[model samples]
Target: MKRFALIFLFTFLLSPKIYSQRCGGGILTFNIYTLNGEDIKEFDYEIFPVSKELLQKNLYEKVVNEQNMNNSDYPLFKSVETSGRIIGKVFVDQIIDNNNPKLNAKLQELLDTSAITQKGTITSTLLFSTRENQSFPIVLKISNGDREVYILGNYFGNCDREASLVWGDKVLKLE
Candidate 1:
């Protein structure tokens, strides 16, 4: 069942011409910066979901095959490439290490079998924008020389069934 699900998800994500945003809203990818008057990077992002795929079995009966799904599914994001110059000091960062003993133990506690979970691990992303003249947002998680930056907010929604990113208080509805 898990194998079927992984394949279903991969095919949907790798396909082109996917719906560009969540069910009702669109994606917001903007520039990120540091506190010392520097633009860190501009991220290209997207959130979207699967178009319901109908299937046929041995008997040729129509089958609604929803893969390993939860109420809130993760978004299918593809980074856009641009030749525009990034005018800022390069920031060195590290991906969260999965092998750390504490994180390893925490991973188990965070994962749930019955429902899709992301409490312990970095599973979701939030986007934010500030009109103030400040260069950086409020939160930056730096570990092992890597800084994890995100829009800090709490949200609850279904991603296992659709492609979406909560991104602060607003629920971006990808089609």
Candidate 2:
């Protein structure tokens, strides 16, 4: 009985650490394009998932409150809450397989083909916070080759218009 108890306790203590390391988060990839469809930049972001406690401690109060108050406006908040599951699918379809039939068809319908080009790789990290009854608030630290851009906003909602860099005074949209 003593040995069995010891074994069970040891396993229980070790399980969380092992599980967190493996399942805490995932990588997200995306392209940056001019409204004209020119893909001038790409990013491979590694997101580290955080617990509710950690999120609250790290994120800004306004960001957290906005997520709680405007839950219905942002679909990406749900993805962030789940630590990028939905966003992962978007990344796969949009960034990994450009020839994916469904996405390609959709893009063809929505965008002009003349301006799109695939190029560049930048690495970055995403940060966020969540409450029990509210959506998550997210921020991105985008590394653009030699420069870094910090984007502050909810995951899928309108990013701060002033937060963008690299476009050199031109207003660009992030799809």
> lDDT of each structure?
0.26, 0.35
- Candidate 2, 103-158: lDDT as tens digits: 44533332222122222244222222212232223334344455444333333222
TM-score of 1: 0.18
* Ten contiguous residues with the weakest lDDT in model 2: 156-165
Q: For residue 68, give model 1's deviation from the true position in Å.
A: 42
* Candidate 1 residue-wise lDDT, 1-175, digit = tens: 9999999999989988855433432222222223334332333322111111210121112212345233123221111111011111121112223345654443333223223233222323333221222111111231112332222111111121222322222222122
State every prediction's TM-score relative to the real structure.
0.18, 0.29
When summed lDDT is taken over every stretch of 10 residues in candidate 1, the lowest stretch is 77-86
Best of the candidates, lDDT: 2
